[model samples]
Target chain A: MTFSLARPSTIVEALRLLADDTEGPTAPLAGGTDLLLDLDDGRSTARRLVSLDKLPWKTLAWDGPRLNVGATLPLARLGSDATVRARLPGLSEGVDAVGSLALRHRATLGGNLGRAAPASDLLPILLAVDATVRLVGTAGRRELPVARFLRGSRQVDLAKDELIESVSIPEARLSTYVWQRVRPANDVSQVGVAVARSGSSASWRLALGGVLPVPTRIPEAEVHLTEERPRPEDVELAANAAATHARFVTDKRASEAYRRRLVATLVRRAVARAQIPPGER
Target chain B: MTSEVALTVNGAAPRRLAVPDSERLLDTLRWRLGLKGTKEGCRTGDCGACTVLVDGETTLSCLTLTHEVQDRAVTTVEGIAEDPEGRRVLAAFAAEDALQCGYCTPGFVVSLTGIRKELGASAPDSAVIEALQGNLCRCTGYLAIVRAVARIGNGNP
Candidate 1:
């Protein structure tokens, strides 16, 4: 089954095309890394594809205190950008771990978040950094926290007529991301953890992925670490607390017990790594 | 909904053809243009047998749509045969005996070409490994392929 593809040069035109249901179901195509695979597999029945490749949103900019990442900015740029590496080190690490170099050159941040895969490397990092997603439609523009934007596995809080405009991350310090994968290279993580600390070291955020229905943060663990500088015992207690909150399932990749164990270990390692001097890592 | 899209393949004159929007660049290259050098492996993006250069950057033709290549230059393995860097990559592959079945060689060669273009000079072993991670080799255990890329990176060929 082949579909007609429409290349919209502007966001308003794209939104209009998406909103016209009388023309049949229309799906937006970005990067086409995952969307093409779905089309080839007969998973998508849309009759029209709205291509976002030529839109003006494929850029990265700094707006005041926050970094504005255009929804169409390729993952390769996100991983290699100097400012992103310095300010959002965890996000850099997470984007670098996605797919391979070739795929990275073509994949976009919007596609990664739009797919909303539970094992997506970018989701946990975005959650840890407290990123916000900017969405636009005929209804005008609104922003949603990254955590709230993701509704469930393979689902996002996106209306059919709305398109993601950009993702903004506020600057922070001492951020670190770590993951343990079955393969050493070019593989998705079996378990992933991200940690970001403020200047005081007392305030920190934590998020985990691949072990829950959605990439999420454990409030109990975050509160435990926010009280003071984390000691080895505190790290251990936080790790266990995070493990208790994670609800893992047995899949071909790993067993439920193994994922639970990995959640604890990765959280500990990520926290420790965040404390290391930038020059050392 | 078929439309005429113009593209430059292998440095040839821009060719215009009518194609369906769902037609992948891989199919257009192989079926329409008869450029069979770009093999189809794991039609999904996992296997990089369909690797090509779009505007000098490594790209997977299988995942790329026909319209995306409009007015863009695409260099396949066939087109790079006479290129100096492409020749060095191919020569290294031969000297290092980097194949058994040879089904995945074109993709590796194209990927190496992109890596050489990016690095511009000798590459560390770690860099070479990272660049070829997308191209998979079911034969030769990838040792000879990695050596071939390293040889090219070291300027030995």
Candidate 2:
């Protein structure tokens, strides 16, 4: 509640402000929906905030099949984009599942991935779609797979002077995000499942969320999805493998046993949802 | 780190004032400007009680930093009547008697007004209802609120 805010219009100034520790650790403020709550409640120890609002990172670009989203673009803007909705349905589903319309209006993809909360609804889809995170710092700009960029909850592969520049999805996929929660909006998922398939390859990519540490892919389950449309038996096998594979979280909000059951059910539903024909869906 | 900030509110001339760096827009509206119409139910973004429009987009004032919206147009429930769409939404809520405790009414009305701006007046009733998922109404069980949304969707509110 007693931190100085720095709104640098350029990336260099923002990095310099973040690197200057004389004022104490500066947390980058993307949308501030989660960070503000953490700072106000003493959960975060940041003594300074570098607002990304002024930076020219609120961009969304599509080059052919690849889509690049600037780190500060709001989740609402991403979800409302017609091409994003059409090409990456699962990503849209994940964006919509984050919070209410008001909250989504301010939440950003960079903030979501930077926080890397275990129960984040966005990560599963990001992993399913094989998104890549681009970062810039004293070491210069580097790109890493989202699977490698995330270290742990409240942890990322970002240095003190580093900033997330953009996230790139290599190509669009047939994908969907499915989860169960007490409430549809602003509630953490008990178990989140995302399934995606490349246009060229019928092989499905699967990821499980609401797990401890980080959301991860389940290659063991994906093998069961052999055809464009998987059979009921293979889907059941895939779901069972998914449930058995994920490291479900043991938070007070959900029982570990219940989470396992939800994972299996959600995995089945997500696979079915992802494999639906485009026009039929 | 107090700084001089300037922003427009309620269709008025830009108000320039000194504000603390960590001040939230919700606090600035309630305490600094005395615009108590924007209630603070949850300091977090879960409750939409602090909903307002920043540059014509629905925003959660609780999660938004005052400095983040510098020089932007802000419209609160106090200024809801200034816009024709907002006025219609407010009148519809009153006609439907959409509130009991009334604590959540302002947020619902503001959110509906924002929906009108985003989706236009002819947006479907289902879409408007889905958009209200952010708002919580302990009293009236959302029956009256649904009626209000229905009235707006009918383009008669």
- Interface RMSD, candidates in the order listed: 1.2, 0.9
| Residue lDDT tens for model 2, B107-152 | 8888888977887777788877887788877674599889988887
Model 1 Cα lDDT, one tens digit per residue, A49-157: 9999889888898886678999998898788787877777888888878887788888999998888888888888888878899999889999999999999888899
Worst 10 residues of 2 chain A by lDDT: A272-281
User: How well is each residue in A170-270 modelled by candidate 2, as lDDT tens digits?
Assistant: 56558999989977767878789988887655588899888878888989899998777889999999989988887877887798889988888998898
Off-target runs (Cα >4 Å) in candidate 2 are A200-202, A277-280
What value does the lDDT take at residue A265 in candidate 2?
Answer: 92
lDDT of each: 0.85, 0.87
Task: Summing lDDT over every window of 10 consecutive residues in candidate 1 chain B, give the lowest-scoring window.
Answer: B119-128
Name the TM-score of chain A in model 1: 0.95
